[model samples]
Target chain A: MKEPGLEQPGIAVEVAVPVRRTPLDEISRVKMLACQAALGAVIALAWQAVSGRLVDDYFISNPLAIGRRLVAWIGDGTIFVHLWATLYATIVGFVIGSLAGVVLGVWLGVSRFAARLTNPYLLALNALPKVALAPLFVLWFGIGIESKIALAAVLVTFLVFLNTFAGVREVDRDLIDCARLMKASRAQVLSKIVIPSAASWVFAGLKTAVPYALIGVVLGEMIAANRGLGYLVQFSGAQFDTAGVFAVLAVIAVVAMLLNWLVEIWQERMERWRIVSR
Target chain B: MIELKNVSKRFRKGDEVVEAVGGIELGIRRREIVAVIGPSGCGKSTLLNMIAGLYPPSGGRVIYNGKVIDDVNTSVAYMTQKDNLLPWRTVRDNVALPLEIAGLRRAEREERADRVLEHVGLTGFEKRYSSELSGGMRKRACLARMLLQGAESLLLDEPFAALDAQLKLVMHGLLLRLASEASQTVVLVTHDLMEAVTLADRVVVCTHRPAMIALEQAIDLPRPRDVINVRFTNRFRELYDMIWDCLRLEYHEELI
Candidate 1:
């Protein structure tokens, strides 16, 4: 609302504001989303057209058949059992691995002697392919969620550790010096400066570790498991059900994308200062 | 009051020994503003760091209030040229850091920080992050934090060298007023000869390397001097010329 008496004395005032122009970045973002959706639609249409005409449904599964199978599984509530199993293992392992990695990474990063001492052993463990160790994990933990959890933890740990180490190593020397001059205690320095400085690197490691967590669980399930998404794919493939395999793969893709979206939201919230400062 | 008795700092390279300052004796009286000026890389900064207790002197002792400092001296607040404000923190939070270290309650510290920010002409910028602020604004925030520390002394290393002429004058005026009001001692390391003459009660000129004091001249200018106006006077010009004369001798030595 405008004050009637505050207007220009002689001329009539256009109190109502004129239209505002949309920002360039916002316009470009909308155009990019539209292009992505259109591209996805084109791919689906081409797949549908080639389903029966060029390739048999028994061999390369049709998109429509896979969609119908997805609907059927959702309606019957059968996919939930396997999905919950894989999700439970992945989430549990991810939490444990991330906690251990961040804690150990910071501790070792701060302690020069300790990092030098454990250099060879940490390198050797990371040198071995995590997937190849799934069999050994299965042998040790039996054909249960324990094996999957172990595998996932092993995969996630190294990633978070390396990023955390790098973050700690490159901490701003000037800030640390300032904190010390302020008479900050050792614990104060750790809690106030070190952890907050390393938070971005830690979150980046967590985001990258998401797919590796899923891969670990799937690998363990494939090696030996009674129920999981990996087992679903294996069971359907053995029965020569290409449609079932494709449907399970599609479910995994959607699940991965959804989890990644959630993490991206979290990263945005954690780094809100960047938006304003920039 | 602070006293440096034959203080010197030396660093060892792989095989060579680099002497920064060599056996320089100085005393800073209570509530005095002393500026150390010289050519580039003359160990002026190293001398200030020792005074701040960021580094130990290789020879002799640095005594503050009649006590030798062995570690970080909380009685002094050191401000370098970089400003060194935390990028992730807002201006208010950055200024509140020293109070936080001192364990003041949140409400109490925030109120103090607010008053200091207002005094520094940054009243409405409490929500702005350090990265969002420009160079001069960030320097103001740093000054606010140093004020919050409320230490007995201030060790400033070219804190306004990066600023423009007009801004530097404004900063010099604010610093002089604040330091004199609080009766706090200040040791400044500056590359600008005019800045030394404008602000210091006494100016110490150091030689190029192994920085012994080349000359210690007192600026007998009137109190409460205007930074720009005082520069046009003869007293300020004479002090600047004297300091520059000592530095010019070193240039001739280097040429030889």
Candidate 2:
């Protein structure tokens, strides 16, 4: 209750400043957070409504009931065991695949003879549907984590290999000439100049390959695994436990987001100079 | 300290064999600065390259310090028109590169690199990358690297052509000062007539295409040359006129 000419000392000014938000930054941040919360709430509400309206509990359980079930699973240590199994397979497969891919890619890119000789073989292998070969992998290595890991590694390798090969090939010729003029020895030129020049491309490839690495692990598990999140999804779906299947999917989405976030952080650290200069 | 005896270079383009330089004989004495001036495509760079041991002549031998030159000679430093600085290395590291490649200890190479950097007025730029530098600064960095090589002779292939007029003059002065102090023999190839007159004790003019020595004029002008003082001098104009007269004929022939 203040006159128009004489405003309240604290309340009016405080409200006015916030309403103005002239910097645009604070306003944008607030708006973004609001949007995120709104979207999350809408999704949750929609899921709750759909589950509530379902005629059969076996087909679609309530979102609240699924949340409770997930909590119970976590408490009983089943979630931890499943997550560990997936993580172990993924890490081992990713490391082996990425290392082999980079080595082969670099060698092929540097030597024309090697590239020419191996191009047809590589293309044939890359073109073949890897998922269709899961049965063969299971047959060859037996139906253990080993077969799944091997399958995952094979799936991840081609993506990394192609990216790295293109990256190495795309290194600037001018930089190479400069190194030659400096009288740099073959090893020095390769390690010091060529590798660093191709670094940005290699990192770009790695970023694109991160999601593929996770997908590879999941695909391998789905084909045949007794303990992974993918196995849980398959088992739940067969039993018509729709809530349990959704819970497994939700865990996978979270893991994927976390892995992608870690990749972005690594990329930022590697390309700090490029970002700062830009 | 360089002797090119009847050096000729030819390039085969499709079915045509074009001679770039024809039987050019030149002797560059120890600590002498020689500038080769000619019209475009007159094979001035080809001659310099032969002297630097970067290219082999179709006929004739290039002798430096009484040794027949074959591949890139360790006793010679050649600076191309392009700066050619490695973007990855800091300025100090780039300057010390030749020494490192020659198997010198890191400590000794760093000391030599520091001395050359100071000599080239780049004392505070040791840690700066080549990508962060301006055109003139990059040229200076290249010059510093050449200085660090401790070569007996320097071959400059239009090293200052990329610079503006003002920067070019400043660089010309810097080169003159450096050449005097180092007492290193230098053979420079350029199309700029005035640059040749200003920096060189002797200038060699060549004819166009299948180039041959048209004239060799000795500049008797006094040392520690002031560009301002020399620019107005009658001797400078006379030398420029002499080189231009020879180059004009070659230019007309090239047009035909």
Candidate 3:
């Protein structure tokens, strides 16, 4: 019955105290917010000065006018259709590419024969410029969402595959020997030893691939698309509405940032037991 | 009970074949602690690996309890020189790995793991990761995991060789006590002569590369031994001199 962290011999109940933030921490946060707001204001004023009016007849529009246009577009369900088209393409491509990469990467890492046979092919594919294949994808899959998804999947697969394969292959050999001596079955060794050991690497691959998925979707739309944010940019540029183009670019930037933030949250949540912090 | 009869191991390097262990014959009785000592590249570790079923002998059989061990088995636990705890797992979960892999229920595994943790002086550190622990604590965790596996025999490959003198003595005491309680048959490989003398019931001295057993000596020290007391005894010096005689001759021959 020793008291915790004391020289007594009695049972003690410990209470966790919430951490108190200092004035310096509060000031730092406020400064960050102020800087962001200032930057946004400067951009808005610059757009107003360049456009010459709140609403233009044919040329570039003002920031306020573009905001109103966005509101109207959202109300008419146009934004929803375009957003859904891009999002659907990204999700489908990410799932298929990531799954294939993880499976093949692990297979290659564990088997010498597989690694030897596929090494040259993997290197040759990785060396090729992924963007150059967009036209081929369109020709093979048409101007539909399938072509866009296929392009995105190809871009993301290599990044994830290399990270996961290296992660598994670089595992501590001593741990493998220990598991083997304990009579672990091949399946158990893979699930319990190999997968958990390579989790950080897999997560690293996923983080890198998330950005690739967004880039793939945008690139696909840039080549040939009737909807999505990239299409919105094209439409605005064609009309000489620079403000509208900037606004659409801003939306894509925000979407990409939001996706990255979501990935960070997921990684942290899944790796609570891991040694390295996300 | 373990026996190695006419065992030989060879490895191919480039175009040449090099013998690692050559024509070795040895037997260890049940619950006996035997220490194998030799110079570097003497293939002591290779012999222990063959006994632990990590490798197969090229010429002869490794019989454990009258059964030839050719592949990995759960009956023996091998402690490597490097601590191999999973970084993701806490001390408790790491210790319970064998039980979990053997399909024991969670509660039962936890209970068994906790008991072993207490034995290793890690009762309050169940949630600590391997990264958070010091070197000695990590080594203790490795020992606790081996104990939780509940193997009848242990093959340790210079487990305490990396520790400083003080920590090595403490760990040696803990290991000897645990082995006594578990009634385990232990085969230890080490280059340290003092370590071989302290914990072993019998010592096997091996020659240089393409190694073979040179001499075997029995130690009849009392239990719950104190190193200070043992060192002061004449029997300690006698065993030390006997081991040195063989080691000195082997060392000179290799140089020549």
Candidate 4:
């Protein structure tokens, strides 16, 4: 009775009506891009004008000050070190967590008895704020990159696990039956049918987990680490350097966007069949 | 040969027990194409499911090739209303799935899949995903996959019901040609009277719910009959009207 939220894993015939583009369409697309750029510029100009005049520089950093701070960090290469540290933890944690989640999800998905038995415990863990586990992770792994990775991994595991579990459960019974009728062995059915069927669902989880991995790494760094973007933000805030904090935040935003783009590329590469070009 | 001896099936929906099929006796000989026609929700599909060993009959037995089918009937290639072709795999890979399951090498699987795909008129579409193909093409791909299984028996549960009239006729011709060449026994379940008359050697009509045999008529059409033009023929019309008459009675009983 559980309908798949994702598209069905079999032949999904979708009509891709090609839209004819006229000069007006091109003009409109250019206009839209221009408007977006104008909006961003307006916001930046307004912020720059308001700082020190409308609000104290200490309270709200000016756009120019934040830009200068970013340039200074880049020139000294200190930004790269913090950036690499955060990136390392995020990537390592994402891989480990995603693997664990997929393994656990598939295991529970295949066996109803195990899913039912561990349902309460799993629910309890998911409900608890994973950030609260940062202190414990720090104690166990020491206030190093391992702690950041552990926190990031913990946050991502729950997210990917839930999506993967639902994906596996939602696989069409008819598809499985089709394989069985073909005399497919149990291992073949799992490998060839079940896993591929749940792939889109797993990718959906991975996409969302990108930002969450950053969040976990940042929070871990803020709580205890001497390195990473989170520590930079924390250190700048303590020193009352509002521009430095803003500069570090901007870098984090860029990193998050970069990670998300990478995941999107990975999904598109693997599931090119789902894409309709337009 | 597939035989159903007083086969019956019941499904429990929460607290209510729904008898899907009841005391149906049918025999399908080797290389024979039999079509089971009935009103919608009359458990025509349940009969095929039982024969495929997807569901054990609530009563009686389903015998296939001198053995009672207790588990999934690996000897039969089953195709349902939905194509059920894997979306991720290209048409060739989907058709070659059974051979891959049988542990054939990649080279052999692809070569055999190409031959079968060509047989189903889908040679040029081997590398395309199912989603990229049209409905009729996807059905052809599905049929190709089923044919590649090399099973002696084919259980088709309204496989061409979703296609247009023209497509249906084309599919009918393709199925007839392929089934006859392979000498595969086909049990086609459908409510389409014309399709039943056009393809089946024998048409078994079942009544409303708790499906039981109402009429069993044989089509004595000659070998290598044209599926499309045969519909316009006098004998085809006679057979169609005869089967429709039996189906009309089932519909009338339901209204009453």
Candidate 4 TM-score to native: 0.87
Distance from true location, Cα of B189 in model 3, Å: 1.9
Between candidates 3 and 4, name the one with more favorable TM-score.
Answer: 4
Task: Give model 1's share of reference contacts.
Answer: 0.64
Query: For residues B1-256, what per-residue lDDT tens digits would candidate 2 score against the true structure?
Result: 6888998999999999999999989998999989998887778878877776666899998998988988766567878777777665788888888888778999999999998788667889888877777777788889888877767788888888767788777777777887788888988889888889898999998998888999999988889998657888998888888778887887888789
- Cα distance off (Å), candidate 2, residue A135: 4.3
State the DockQ of every prediction: 0.48, 0.19, 0.35, 0.47
- Tell me the interface RMSD of every candidate, in Å: 1.2, 3.4, 2.2, 1.6
- Models 1 onward score TM values of 0.87, 0.78, 0.81, 0.87
Residue A157, candidate 2: how far off, in angstroms?
3.6
Q: Ten consecutive residues with minimal summed lDDT in candidate 2 chain A?
A: A13-22
Candidate 4 per-residue C-alpha lDDT over B1-256 given as tens digits, one digit per residue, 9 for 90 to 100: 8999999999999999999999999888999999999998999888888888888999999999989999999999998877899989999999999999999999999999999888767878888888888888888888888888989899898888777888787778989998998989999999889889989999999999999999999999987989878888899989988889889999999889
| Error at B160, model 3, angstroms | 2.8
TM-score between model 2 and native: 0.78
lDDT of 3 by residue, B40-150 (tens): 778888898888877799999899989998777567998877788988888899999989888899999999999988876789999988888878788888888987777
Quality class of the docking in candidate 2, CAPRI style: incorrect
